[model samples]
Target: MKDTKDSWQDSWFDTCAALLTDPQNLRVWSVIVSLFGDLAQRPGDRLSGGALSRIIMPAGIKPEAIRVALHRLRKDGWIDSARQGRASAHFLTDYGRAQSAEVSPRIYTRAAAAPEAWHLLIAEDGAGQTALDDLLLAEEYFSIARNVALGAGPVPEDIDDDLLVFDASARTVPAWVRLRACPPELSEAAHGLLRDLSQADALLPRTPEAISPLQIATLRMLIVHRWRRVVLRQPDLPAAFFPADWPGPACRAAVFDLLDRLPRPALAELEAE
Candidate 1:
């Protein structure tokens, strides 16, 4: 009976892992970014190469692929590696940590944001176009058109003189506007993640002891990687901005449910493995 149960659990884990794997955006570097952001974004946190390999390799990432990805990330100023004797350790660089910090709140937030106030900034056709573009890039303003941008929360006190600004709220959201705000690809990705999370949740063993720390780490990385891609790309706009069928809220709920079940293991626990 013991052997039979073990076999069943092993098979279930393999299936769940397979279901969670995303081949479409399987860039090793991006996965590493997610892992670091999730587990090692702290000031002094770092992971040895062996630990990194163990955590990421279970997701079908090759050791050589990890080495290549690390090199690319280092070259691109997203990560830094140091060697002490024969062992090497990797950590996010300042730029990388900053980038990770920028999105960590949104990615890890348990509740969705509902901004109390909203505003719009409109630029003259040719006069303030460059300034508006700069604002869109530098700030969290969503671009509605070439000359108009929408922002959440209160209007800024010191506003740009070249642009016209208004404290606004949505009166009506048409299909065209909804499609523009939440594109088909974004919606598809959200639904796909929702399905994957649901399937994995169903297959996961009920007994938490059945799952190993390494397995937990690997699964968390996969979940966070896919979730990060979707959440970061899609702004946290009000429901009116999204189509009625948008799966983002559902996907987020599922993602957090799975994450709560698969709690993060300590760095020492991961490294010990």
Candidate 2:
């Protein structure tokens, strides 16, 4: 009986070690997730800062590490923080908690969608072919890509109603975009933007460009986001994810508008680049 118990203990320890070592698991993120899980299952609605720290402390992370991790998580929209006295009380966003609940075998798998508006798709060279660095880069890119697609401050006004499409096929990428509406004179604008995006210095640093490595990463994640949205919106969408939006063809129109807005050279360059 003593030998059997010892063997069980050893196995348990090994399993834990494996879980901690796996990069896909995002150990710090898991800590946040587990913390939220506990809160979710709690009899009360929220957790106190001290209670959260106590729960996280046993995981072998230091106080400073926890603080930094929490900050990053909140900044990235994974969690929310509320000032409660001297401590920042942390709570998981629906997105973060959903991400945390995924286990090893299911880490990259998509989850059921929560409430959200708009969807984006990214077509990468290979699916599920990325390292931890790539994953982190992709996360950052998605944030920026979201802004670019919606015509944020850093990007030019030309993309106001356009979707910024980044093609990552060569040394310098191009952001081929298409707009929702077009004036007859601007028919060639898509081709022009594509050309500009293909140029080496098309995008200035910290501004939306066609070839930013960050944009490449964003494309990868947006695909995941799009896939999730499709699944979520399917029930309400009648013609499937690709046949275009239901009732008339507004969804299809929007997609084509985006395509039309893409620079002519950029459109051709996608297959070649």
Candidate 3:
């Protein structure tokens, strides 16, 4: 940060961060989650406050914001901090690690997870509401209507309600259904990320080696953070299940392409600089 004015003029990191950081909507706590999940999810991995600031400050987050976020995360049992002599180091708690691990596959996978076996669950109009709500937590279930849920894989055996199940395949899904499957707001986020990915990709150094490890970490955090929001919210279904214009496939491709170019750096490399 000492030479930030000069670095801004010369570094690709600033321009890419500018393009990727949602200033109006930037959530420091979420950004920290993305950072820790990407670089320090391992049990013993930690990021010292000094290194944390170096990586995040370039994204325009103030140190006070990060401090408040760290405090909130600690209070919520998501992170633990300890004194490391003159500086402090922070790492995820077991609960935090579990949460991050839960979503790692969806966040990191290069290929989409589309399954062929489809099933349907139906509930009595007003009586089985609780069962349906619980089932929605699993990735396989998608609420197609008030009383119905379409899912992948075998039907569950544990529900207590008088629920009906159907093993079905869709020969034809209507446009309205597809639109309902992925609403307009989700579509806009996907397209926005794709556009930013292209912009950030263009801003990077011509050769991968030219970028420092911290710079790589900064950009990767932004890419993965934005992507996590989009991918985790969209329904887990086949590409054909969504609208023909859905940007899911294209955005996924662009994300992995840029992330592959900026391969994740080691915690040691990131902290050292």
Candidate 4:
């Protein structure tokens, strides 16, 4: 088993990466996840806003950012908080736990703290795992996948898209992957995992192993599922998060350019599969 400290650090790192990539409420969500994740390891597995402020605010974030994030997290069912004496104590919800499990199988690798909750990772077949991975990759490559499916439409719209008639078919591919029947709490956890993966890219031990094309396809599928959450949450999110006069106009632009350049069957074709 990995060291407990290492695991904790990895969890927080994942939360950060997800916050940065969040299509909406990026900063707000980051603080909330950071606070709750930290509390998850505390003495009573809980902490108060004042305690959290001492930890997150010193990092130079504004107080408003922390408050907004925490409020939204609570509203969205990712966490629960109450007055513990003079301080506000916070704890993860079952939904948060399930979503966390989705991000890293390691979170669910051992027995659960609650016996009623099932771990989806423990339930997936190898193909299901690959499919989930591919969904994520597909979301990352949405523009490309769309163009490859049916020419070009709009630029990559901040991870949201038109109600693709094909999304239904794509969902079926990962149907075998039995996610723990939980609420949107898992959504927050998924964001947490994304944050960690993005930030800890450098620290994670680089495996020089050769990955198969099938694995890449599976990853793409996972990306799709990951981004689909944003789509479901915000049907009409904005685009062009990049600032004006940004030195690299082509950075995000290049993603769409490549999207239009892909050779595979369009997203429609994948759905037809």
Give the Å error, residue 120, model 3. 0.9
Over 29-112, each residue of candidate 1 has an lDDT whose tens digit, in order, gives: 999999999889998888999899988887888999999999999999999999957999899999999999999999999888
lDDT of 3 at 109: 86
In model 3, pairs of residues that clash are none
Q: What tens digits encode model 4's per-residue C-alpha lDDT throughout 25-89?
A: 44646445533432252233565565455445433456788788778888888877889787677
Q: For residues 124-164, what per-residue lDDT tens digits would candidate 2 score against the true structure?
A: 33432233224324332222132332111233233213243
Task: Name the runs in model 2 displaced over 4 angstroms.
Answer: 1-26, 41-44, 98-273
Deviation from native of the Cα of residue 132 in model 2, angstroms: 22
Name the lDDT value of residue 84 in candidate 4. Answer: 75
Which structure is stronger by TM-score: 3 or 4?
Answer: 3
**Cα lDDT tens digits for candidate 3, 170-225:** 78888878887889888888889999999888887777777889988888898889
Pitting candidate 2 against candidate 4, the one with the higher TM-score is 4
As for lDDT, the candidate ahead, 2 or 4, is: 4
Q: Candidate 2's error at 44, in angstroms? A: 8.3
Q: Could you tell me every candidate's TM-score relative to the true structure?
A: 0.94, 0.29, 0.93, 0.33
> In terms of TM-score, which candidate is strongest?
1
Please say which candidate is ahead in lDDT: 1 or 4: 1
